[model samples]
Target: MNITISLKRRCEHVTEGTDEAGSGSLLNRIYTELYITEGQSEEVNTQHEKHIRVVLTNGVAGVGKTFSVQKFTLDWAEGLENQDVSLLILFSFRELNLIKDEQYSLLMLLHVFHPTLQKVTAEQLAVCKLLFIFDGLDESRLSLDFYNREVLSDVTQKSSVNVLLTNLIKGNLLPSALVWITSRPAAANQIPPEYVDRLTEVQGFTDAQKEEYFRRRFSDEDLSSRIISHIKTSRTLHIMCQIPVFCWITATVLDHMLTTDQRGELPKTLTDLYSHFLLVQTKRKKQKYDEGHETSPQELMEADREVLLKLGRLAFEHLEKGNIMFYQEDLEQCGLDVTEASVYSGVCTEIFKRECVIFQKTVYCFVHLSIQEFLAAVYMFHCYTNKNTKVLEDFQEKDWRYSRYSSDSSLDNFLRRAMQKSLKSENGHLDLFVRFLHGLSLETNQRLLRGLLGQTDNSPEIIQRAINNLKEMNSDKISPERSINVFHCLTEINDHSVHQEIQEFLKSENKIREETL
Candidate 1:
């Protein structure tokens, strides 16, 4: 009804950055500092008292809710008539997973409070007017820890859910009076109803806003004009901009796509847009060869290439292997560097570097979806036991019927070839080894083995090399128990298959009996 309501709606229009719309993310700061939360002038500051401003802003992810919230907090704080009393404290629920206990949550608040107030009491927080921006309800803690280990207990309120709800309703952690709870509707439903205000969902950017965005990305005025005109007339482009993030993604993608693919047509959907983006990235890499510039992200890519190719080599050896999720920390022992932040190539590396690789739970597959499929398909090909020639041919040869699989199959095939090239060490990524894999538990290492190559019985031809390596690991270096563990992981994928060869293989090797017994 008022500007605050209007402000909430306007926030949805932004795809990038602002206090309300962002978690103050440094990555790809869209910085859309435009949202007005009505003339809540009286609401926020009643008769110059500065009514505890509980600013509730909510919208879908990538809709820029955090960005708007951040902008509002800074602006409101700057505009405040009184400096000492009015303060904006920003908190994110995502970070609480590390310490989910109520006392710990209070400790976090007290700690933050102490930094500013210098031994200020928690009781004092209520007396003073404070502006708090609690963000990322959707990403809150599912569990908590004590002494740095997830102190798992059957306590419900002791659970992350209770800690958050208690703080909002009873604890009044942001008790400064004004609390803004922002979340997507689905996520908003998660928070206790008593504290949060009426639900407000941001309705993304308008057509004119998208046009302006595209104009900014494009340097050429004429090109920008023509593009906007084309987008307005085009059915797909007009439909795509219904949300802010999509608009930004579309604009960013289209800017690059139209330039390289300038000769032909424009991409319609996000999929085509991604394909074009990948292609542009591919082209950007190719520029090195033409100009002969040696160092680039390609160096990192080349090393990554080797590991993926080795993974493919291992996978083709074991396609009928059980399970798909490969835990990386377990895959690379000496345990991924145990810190709070891992160094990343970005602007905020310094702030986040100390805590890197504390990833006991962070599992990753290949970089892209297409690459994962490529590895799967490559592994499937080597599994001679899966003699469904049609399925094998479907993945490998790409005959007429196979061609009908999906357009994405080509991209999958693309990664396969890329890895295959790297495997040969002909192009891309010279370092084929994942140094971490050597340190995994014999159990996990055996599992990765199974992921690459099937059990001993239905094993594929390409996996012969890997099999030889496992045999060497078993006989020459390791103990018998570890070798048997690996053997179990591979063959267990089809312990009950129809193949008599496999049945006999399992029986003679005693693999099935080992796990079951």
Candidate 2:
């Protein structure tokens, strides 16, 4: 088989921004710019040379790095883009981790993954144009250990995968082959700066791309236009749309609510949006049952609430451990069977895809990381409002888990502890949760959750305390990004009057005294 034929793979759900040559994206230019070999005449080889040997693409989670890599590789293989590249070999570190300790010759590595390559000579590797695309260095469990690993020149030499990877990256193996690596910014640092020829960051979607996405997503022109206009009108929502995954979530929630003619205002805050989406999914499932004329085992609405709380607990516990992927055991611990869990497949997403990883068994995760965070917040809200301890039966102390109905003092204590924990959390993982806690305390959101959960009267004292905490956090010592997020969180729960009050207080001479409070 031809190398290009052997390499052909489908690109799935790739969006508009990857190929567009916009001036804002330096990353696109770096990838598209063609380079020729130094010794060849410009006429003969100018288009054939691959400019950068190693391009490091960095982005936050859910910014579509994997999608872009798949799209690029497929485009090349299909002769739609980068025709100079004769072969593309793609590997994800998540899959690579399974064989990290194994030793293999370069040929063996290719053959194991792509048996069709066996007919090709190992010598062809050195002469043929090859592109190595490594996705998700952040997911890799193996230590690259660039400093400690010994380099090997021979491609056929046996070594651990990381050593082989280090050698290949350092130009000790297949020095001329083009390599591309994708990682989260934090993980991108693992590769030495000297070894990388080009660095690019995928900043998700631009405003034009966001417009294009909605236009493509919704066939109803008026509805699509309305959604676009709504997103543009909300400054917070517009900023969130820059992330493709967040855009998908927003589109999903808005599309359903709009189409169904749901009453009340569209959700503005992250918590409100996620809650609306969950309710939409539940109503959808209820409609399916109504259409089927089938007798469901439990009340469709009641089951929805039950499943959400269970899933929220699962999300919270797993997030605490920094575990995004879950196995059967994890689901079992949450009192969920595969069949029962599948009911949440629409909203929670089946993160436990069996086909993608080395684990033959299925794994589960939230559709997006933010969903997990939102669900975690929901779990916290449910616990505080209802005094539900079933979710926290494993914990011995329940000091902070008091019901909001318990007493003013208890609710105040819980909010203080929660805010303190959120402010101190590394990476702001709990930021959304904190926001949700505040948002859920609102009379509007509480009314929305009325039957699904117990009532949590919004406390003026707690709100004031939380506002003060945010003001303190916005101090110079805190990161500007964190301060900005704090501002967003305050907007979600506080009254408009409070926003102006905080703004005035921030500018006042008493700012230091307010910060002390």
Candidate 3:
């Protein structure tokens, strides 16, 4: 999908006004235009002009920042755009993290990753125009000591990978080279604001673009139309379609439900949709790798339960630490081997993926942050069902007085404790995780993933208690943003009373205002 890019100038004193007009389709065109404009402005202007050297682009996960970087590099190599640059080097932080402990000169580092650059001397690099693109700063495990790292101007001087990167970004090495970095918003501050000349944000897709995506996604006009209509029916889904990955997920779930004989009511809640999506991917895996004989959804899940749970464990552990990327050791910690990880990745390629970086090392991560959150919730619920007190205690450390280990601890109380913990998060990283946790409390969703989740008390009494707890949650105790998530949790559990009450209250307030006017 084509993403919208908004540009902003980062000044020493304050951020300059955002230039929405500069937003463009291709990343290459956007950077090239800015570079060319700055070059032209330098000749005629006497005042000091900011040279567009380092551009930091921020976007949430699955918002297509990496895709834009790939497209930009491709366009440059194809000579369709940005021909002014003599060399373009792209590096992902995930790959860089593999060599974080190694020491190498900047030139040597280039040679190690891109052998074609081995013959290029420091003198040649000084004269040639170059662009260095670093993708996925959010995945970096490197300690970027930007402020305290010793300065190294010589590209041939050996230093730690972290030091080399810090110097390069600070313009102490290869000062003339243009540097571009892409990161999710959470990790964008790794590079100090003073080093960034321009800040760009990738706003995934506009409403018109969303419609265009669906139209192109399906060849059948009727199916595409129906999917689009269904998406529009839910405000939450429509807003989430702004992320291209979520659009793909929606299409995958809806398409399977519409085309198959399992024509049940269309999914309305996020949990409902994800449950169907999990089944769909499992079915696809069976069809591809197993015998041609059809099997029930429960049987398919049963076959893959071990691997999925291992993955879920991985997701849960990392979710607690606010980590999305995983290495071999991370997987090993969760009792997952490379082979098991491969099987799971093969099953749900979009949900989990393994990328072979430079050398033979591989990096693993969920396709989107939301997927990690969902799986983490599933794993946490599994722990609760199996009476895994250790995991529960670790999660609810601050609420140990709540008797989480007691047999009488209900799903409502467990979810309330999780919700409280999520509210304590300043970044709200656990918001979706808690939402998914509440969603899993519903018997409908539990039944959908019966095999994977195992047995749970999703009885009506428990479900109603959970919904009531959500309704009674004090909005004053949390930020306005988090309060909205409480409402979302209610929606996920198929409760509409809170929504109806809010609408009625708004109507009454509006009528009173009209009378006063």
Candidate 4:
């Protein structure tokens, strides 16, 4: 069924500048454009049915792909949107992956995941219009052998998890089922193009929507306005604000900084932004602890630093294994007591969330994939600069331009090592970490990270070396997205000369990087 819904307009400060008479109509059009059909409905016969059976919604990390799907399903379930879509079954690939090793028929799979469905007969399910929402295909570890899997028509047929999914999507099993799969752009290829009837991207918020989000997030009008102005002033930060998660992070960080009378410049780069946020959270936690006890400020700061380091280590290690969620043992492995880790709810809790898994088991994961990557970079920086004192001492005395033969204390060696580690992953898994590593070499970002690390010398030189290493790497072999990420890494350095060099390099090579840049 073709579904369309109109939303009521809510008068607000951001919309005050627009035509008041046209606001209601504009809201109607927006909702219609967001959910209305863009193509003609396909024909159906006794044996065949068609109408965009498979819809693939793609987005980058933290762009709200899963949230959009959730909202859509919830609205449908509430009879507020897409009322014709009955039986909306939502499954996250993260949870689905846990059962990839287990053998189960499609009927059993549904029974195990949704027990209520067991009461419905197969004939009833076939007749009704069902929407299956599969979220986070990027997190799936199942080997989906779509090309090789044989078609199975029976729901009671047993097969590998991938085979079941492939057959279900291919119309061999439950052909009438309408499937909506949400994934990061990188993993959209797991399902071949032939299977997808419609592809849409969740582009996060628009400029006006961003303003609305800020107003809703911060109750203080003056503070929210200041933040809006601050974000508008910085091009890089403003561009990143297009993402919903980044907007939340900005609002949270600026709220604390503005009220506390921060003296330094606001964060312009991603690393600078996250570093400031981390420092603010740690300091806030320390202050709370200091108020109750006679603990010294230094001692509190030391404890906070230790907690952050342990969390960072956990983030880095689990990220390498492609694990966003962990168990109690994982916390213990990071030298963190469960109670101590739980107390980190204020500072790092956003990064590490505790949730119940199957069988009443509890699991912890970074709130978002990018958070894990960001903390991984922070861990790498902490390891080379703070934990290892010799590296900081050598940075002060050594001529880092030349390679060191004596030890790994050389900043150049450390920078090269970081690049190597990040570049080894072809999936571009380490793209953010690589970008943040370059950003960490900037003096401004280092200043923000100072509470967790020692003072640095010749950070600009290290940044230059890292940039050179990036340039030496083959970009043509990787996706254009990675190349754009490389450009973003250059911008994170926040150096005019480096920007100019990038412009020259692009000009000489006859290449135009991302238009947004």
Candidate 5:
């Protein structure tokens, strides 16, 4: 769980020559030098540091941001570091969302969450040096209206949770207290730059760290070496290993495949890997909960098909709206009951996670965003195979020509429309979803997911059509960032023509440059 973290100062704006090659750049250089690793020391080392009142940390989903926050809190509680502060209050946005509508004075709020503090008077709280850690701003449901909200400077004054949070962050309430906020990159801007004294990022793992992660995970040296070597062979897998969660997924999958007698080539493509992962989880669920009966992979999946599809529906609907966190109501909306949802976490802990933030109110989310995308794709494909035209029509609203009743609803046409829809997205959030959709089209993946997907048209012509559609996709209109995904889709389908052509083109260009030199 230990990963590398890089700390840097927040820059309002970047311009050429601002820190260009001079002693003036020393300030920026000092920030870059601050790297923290859990294995090294409990203390964070910094040079030429100033008093940091409010810090904002941003990292991608599943990049160990929450882990770092937990470690910091644990270290503080154990008196391993930062003993100067009298009190440290850790508030995750997920838990805070439960009481977002309630009004409480700063003192009352503290007393409610920490009952031990109920006896502490407001006068005593005002003088105590405190640090407030707000984690997962991306999952917040509260309206943090910092600009227009009325501010109360008194600790005894009652107000909405939003107001209290804004006022505290703005230094209007308890200005002497230190504040630390963590969020995904997209949601980091929620806290205005003026309120942040420093910015840090959880960079996940370095190359050396990735190797160490596998070595530590597996007790068998040979197994760990094989896992590391296999990961290195796949460029996509190696790059994804940089994210700690993805590394765990990779380890889980490879370990299951290598240790078991199941006969097949190691999964190279994302779709193939996930397909195996699903099967592995199902098998584990059976062994753990179902009297240890031996069941075929398909039967294992069939046993959990209904609940998995419900979860998939939840993943697909929320993924469209860019929501990763889900409430109990959200789960019910997708036809998933509390008992059914718990089965997922109880069995496949890494695939789905449920956290009891406070008051026994649980919050749920897929372990990683990519898994959500994968499940969403699975759900979408299931809809297609069942001819659930209502779902398809809702997804493909712009394409009036392709109706639910239309006879031309082939895999190629369906996937092409999905590609077009994903490209239209401004932030490319749907890029991975679309890639997973295309990946699911492969006959190999279809067979692997046959239990959940039901009967599919796995004819050679149908599969070829889907592959050809991806290869001939027009990329000129889209940004290069999104365009690269088309090639990834092609890779998923095991079509390497585009990749080989690119390699040849690069080689020829290099040869021409060599001749000119």
Candidate 6:
């Protein structure tokens, strides 16, 4: 693809855009929305009978691993199930967190399969047949190797290190059925031996693929050719083109930017791409607002951490008085109203969709764990000067960088009503609150909480609460939210765990350490 198209053509037709705050939004929607790209899905159907069991899907962050797993699961259910057999149990390892053992993870999987398990203990699960899709091995905090297979005689005879040594240390954890794992190459060590033999990697779209997808999106051959050239040639855009989201970002950029073809340098870093991309997008969105568009969304804004915190704070403050999922009317109760607010909201939501920040269907969430980390970093650096005050209200395991999109007006309205109506109350709204919390990740949480605690308003209370939660969360009663949050709060900024933004945060501290240490 050439890099010399009009910016509008470059920016059009993205599935969604990427955001640092919007994590988990993309994968959650993948299997449910959009067709699985052919490059990845072609080989999936042939594996229905390979008694070998356990499949693994590998790719970079935004490639189609999770989506493929989901599509496979759905297809498997439609074909593989006979009258006696039923239900596939998919476990996202990202949801499992730093659980102590493969057995522990199995135990958790058992619980999800609990309703299906007639009388099986986690130990008894061996006899019971089921399917497992363990997603996100690379993103997990603990590193376990999976490439080579090994034998495990007994899991009960060892120490903590043995438990962590998954490749050589199998226990009652191995199931008697089908399973799959997904991850990127960088985090390959996190996968255990159980998955190595079953590994599958996602190769990016081919040039013909780009032509097919782009042409479907826009009819003009010359325009599609221009976009294809940019996708093939632009170095930074080239990286994104490898991932589906970047393809969408490319298309969206082509569609809107009037900057015309100035031979400006492309973004060198992911953040550079996002920042430049968002700037051009914000310009186009402002145009829609200027034209005087309105909707039923009560209030919407180009919700960043600042805007979300402001709105969520008021919502939380009001909800602290109770438990509810606030709606348009509830927004009014929170002393928030006016339709003009989310004008940026609806359009900004599209920003998330085009870039693949979240699912482009009815319910969406942040696309990656990194997005929330970035948002938390941004909030700590700029929004709240106080080191302890949390920037969000009613958070949970999955929050939206973008939720699913609906092309139908009625369906869109229905989902919005469902979301808004869900928010009308408090405690019952716990799920609603967490719907967005899904946007945060362990690594991101670890970076944001440990790194930014000093600059927060309620750092002491937050830290203590997290530690206390840790005390309560053991192998027996692990809380997903509790476990991940504790890991987030306790994990120091390990230099080994450096992200692109770490150096920026380290600069001020390095100066002080230079004088002291």
- Maximum-TM-score candidate: 3
- Tens digit per residue, CA lDDT, model 4, 1-517: 1121211111111111112112222222222112222331232111232467888787777776755664565456446788787677777787777778888888877777765566666667778888887888877878888797488888888988888899888888899898888888667778887677877778778888788778876788998999999999887878888887788778878887788645657777788888766656566555542233333323444656777777778887877676666678888999988876343555665455665545566666676676777777777777676545553343323443322344555555566565555556666777787778777777666655655655555455666776676666636775676667767777776644556776799886665455435
lDDT of 5 by residue, 299-349 (tens): 767877887898899999998887888998998898888775454542345
Who is ahead in TM-score, 3 or 4? 3
Ten consecutive residues with minimal summed lDDT in candidate 2? 17-26
Regions more than 4 Å wrong, model 5: 1-51, 287-295, 339-350, 399-408, 458-477, 501-517
The residue pairs found clashing in candidate 3 are none
What TM-score against the true fold does each predicted structure earn?
0.47, 0.76, 0.84, 0.77, 0.82, 0.43
Q: Which one wins by TM-score: 4 or 5?
A: 5
Candidate 6 positional error at 489, Å: 32
For candidate 5, give the lDDT: 0.75
User: Model 1 — TM-score against the truth?
Assistant: 0.47
Question: How far does residue 370 in candidate 3 sit from its true spot (Å)?
Answer: 2.2
Clashes of each: 48, 4, 0, 0, 0, 91
> What's the lDDT of the predicted structure labeled candidate 6?
0.40
Q: lDDT for every model?
A: 0.40, 0.67, 0.76, 0.67, 0.75, 0.40
Per-residue C-alpha lDDT of model 2 across residues 1-517, encoded as one tens digit per residue:
6556655533432332212211122223222211111232222213323666777888776777876786677668668898787678887776676687789877778777766677766688889888888898866667898896587888778889888889888778998888999987656668877677777778888788888878877889999999999998776789888777788778878897677645668777777887666666555555642232222212443656766777888888876665555666887898877676454454334222223454453445565667777777777777766666555333223553434354533544555566666666556666666777777767666665554556654567766766676666667866666676678777777545546776797788587778889
**How many clashes (backbone atoms < 3 Å, residues ≥3 apart in a chain or on different chains) does model 2 have?**
4
Instruction: Provide the lowest-lDDT 10-residue window in model 1.
Output: 431-440
Q: At residue 299, what lDDT does model 3 achieve?
A: 76
lDDT by residue for model 3 over 1-517, one digit each (tens)?
A: 1111111110111100112112124333322111111122122322324677888888777777766776676666665779899888878888888889988998988888776666789899999998999999988889898897499999999989999988998899998999999988778878887777777788788887888888876889999999999989997788888877788789888888787666468887898888887888777766531232343656777877888888899999998886888998998889888775455443556467766768988788876788888888889998888878788878985547435456447788889789878888887888889989988888778877777787777778888888888777755767898889998998898888888999999999999999999
Candidate no. 6 TM-score: 0.43
